[model samples]
Target: MTTIPRISLSGTNYEIGYSHGSSLKAQIARQIEFYYGMFQYSSKLDREGVHSRARDYEATILKLVPNLHQEIVGIAEGAEVDVLDIVALNVRSEIALGEFQDGCTSLSWKVTGEDGKTVQYLAQNWDWVRPVQQNLALVEIQQAEKPTIKMVTEAGIIGKIGYNSASVGVLLNALRAPPTDTTKLPVHVLLRLCLESRTAAEALSQIEKYGAASAQHILLADLSGAQCLELSPIKHHYIYPNSDNFLAHTNHPIENIAIMEPSQFPGSKERLERTYKLVETMSSKNISTKQLREMIFADGENGNFGICAPEDMCKPKWFRTMTLFNIVTCLKDGEPTAEVVFYNGSTDWIDPQNVVTL
Candidate 1:
């Protein structure tokens, strides 16, 4: 593959969604196919069942964020697919539950510079099955009232891993434990809401208000600082950076919350530990983006299941997960100082990969 498609969208919510859907119609179909296969293999849920769950989420989103709902509608119309299909893609986390596991490591580091300014960074390795790798898209949305969003998401899904013009960024890790409540907004929709916010606090408020449909870990950071929201269907928890001024999250929950479904990915714990161990070697106050990149690219004994997961052919299709892409965003203290880097291609950090800087 050359590089992931980079799409720039600007207009009303429906127009933006229409552009996204029409521009990526083929990729969106492929995304639907991939998710359908995963749903069947992981949870025994057919397309009908997935759409059934999606309908409830559609109603909830329409009730809560109507403009976003319009966007979803536009996507369906533009893609020439049912609206529920896009909704199914958006709410895949809640629908899959613990049956389908996604392995991702998220990190946030905040350092006080010599000039009494704070240098904050948010980064993640988006790990998933290999088949969907080619379906991923880098989407930038320019909305009317909300801040502009630049996110890397699966073709049909609107909300995902990305940062906004306001310096508010979000990283997602799907949790295994869950009692999914279809009455609330799904995690992906909540992610879009967070990205629309001007600050991390506003994002938190949105989560608290709409609540989550299932369990998810959302690592949120802004110009001020960073905080991890460990959201369960019923209750939520927060994880802050340690005294070292750095925080890392894997697939497991750091707080003492009830886990209904045991995690299938055993390497989550190891990856979290490994990330911390790697951070130990870097200076907290002077951590550079290069150091952060090295941290995500650290692949060793946990090859098939490391922080940078590599696909294992021996494993079943659903179990074959690898790092799809990596994104790192830095919010500094000056004009035009904000930095966003996206890495796509081979896991080898030394390889000549497609790197995009914005």
Candidate 2:
């Protein structure tokens, strides 16, 4: 009798001082598999449900040739890693959470995989970039349970909206490369991993991941809270939790690093300062997680979007957002239910019941 071999997918789990709870962990693995299948056959995914428009943008990622798998050390499962490496934190810095409470998340940085690392993919999608800037939009992702609306790019992959049973939603933008070594893990996977963590502290634990290569800004929030900060450089990875704020992350050089640490990216620092300013000044009216998405696309006025005066970007501008995304996830009490959302322009939300495959 011959048996098949399974490969291990490496990922880091960070935490302030908590766990993702047992039930949620199991559910996360299942959800990951579901998202993978959906991603692998996204076009069919939307249609299999009810009135689907998957063909609109999801078709791109669904049609994407899985090229990064080549660098991995094992077989594939359309989307590998049927597991989740998570992190948890007890508290965060108010300075960090200040960004979202106000509006906009534009932290930036970079990542570098080690010599013997096995990376899965290296994809960079500037939802605010050219070619597709003409169609900055958002829509609802119809699922069976409830709606987990999202904002998507013309190409998909970039999911920035919707909430699950937890009333928790996030708006993520690529500040830099999301590590694929599995050892260090990808930010998307990590952020999605955070979705599974029950509380803010629980999810922080889900972030303790390996060191590889990557960087970016996460404008995360729930009905109760919101945060925006940079993913610090890998080599000098550190976690700092304080009172007042529950969680706070940034991409610049952390407070305490060895003398030989690398320098922070110039653009990243500027974005951080600007983010602080945006949060401090922006007004809070007609600002739902959905509307803030416009900031990610084309904010005619710099009220929320990353448009206007100093176009903050690395050569790519149009898609750059003060809030270049509109992803939502409907979770109950921070525990993920059957709802998930990914948005771009005016993406609607996805209902929980709809995500289930009959």
Candidate 3:
């Protein structure tokens, strides 16, 4: 029998990363790149103008992994054939990538294939003081042997990776920088590029290196508190032991390394404020995961900000989603089984392995 790469999260010990399926990397990448291309690689967003930011993403990738193009570019090229078709395939629910902030503290998991396995890690959240900015964030550690789960995303590769083995996926809105020759090297090209890896690290490397798009953060977590690094072109890494109980993220580029640059964006502030508000609610003694779900899905109008796109996201033809989530198989042996919820209000979603065991 073939031991395929099935992404199941069971108390941090078990299988993850590349599953036995048809081009897991390409399937993941096509979903993202095609959407960007369909929308012509632009969003109705203001602040953090992305067209110019594309260059920054390219530069950052070059610095992070200079030889990435040779390793994963082929996957990106193959996916291009059906990117447009695939983008049009699914519009029922947009792909989202994230984890419950509270559920993912201090968990570890591993993903194995024909090659050696890689560990996915998580510590408590922290704060960061970058060269020009500062913020609070959670901490996670993992390596990339085409890292199967623990990794950082590149610029312009919006919603970058971590979706190959789980139902959770994230699609980002590119705030590209200016001075771009948008004629040939648009950012949409990179989304397809990112989906070409079996691990989070591999996807991250692909996006960062070949990323021609502009800037956006790409941090995703599975249900077990396993996290990935999302290095934006303009980063502002934060420190740990913050107060987010439920899994959450904003525009802030979080890194504990202290070498990241400062990020400047109104969206980052807004998302941070929103995250703080969530933390407050979760920290309450009475708050439960159900309430946390409500908070995530809460909104003022019928179109709930609860799992909604940013208020400024007005592009009718863009990758619009509320409460984007990605569940990876990054759990180590000591954590709990992974599960997720949708609309930030549903019951926890258990993986198939847990279901079978139950």
What shift in Å separates residue 297 of candidate 2 from its native position after superposition?
9.2
lDDT of 3 by residue, 266-357 (tens): 34445445545555544334332233334443322223232233222442333332332222232333332222221122233222332211
- Give lDDT tens digits, candidate 2, residues 240-264: 2233222323334334232122333
**lDDT scores of the candidates, listed in order:** 0.80, 0.30, 0.30
When summed lDDT is taken over every stretch of 10 residues in candidate 3, the lowest stretch is 129-138
Tell me which of candidates 1 and 3 scores higher on TM-score.
1
Tens-place lDDT digits, model 1, residues 1-358: 4357889998988998999999889999988888888888888889898887788889999999999999999899889999999999998888778776568888888876445567788878888888787788888899888888888888889899888888888999878886889888899999999999999999999999999888889999887788989998778999888887788898887893754557455788898888888877766665656666665554555786787766767878876777777777777654312233333445454243445654
Off by over 4 Å in 1: 112-117, 335-347, 350-353
TM-score of 2: 0.39
RMSD to true structure for each model, in Å: 2.2, 17.3, 13.0
By lDDT, the best candidate is 1
> What TM-score does candidate 1 reach?
0.93
Off by over 4 Å in 3: 1-71, 74-215, 218-239, 243-249, 252-271, 284-314, 319-321, 324-337, 341-358
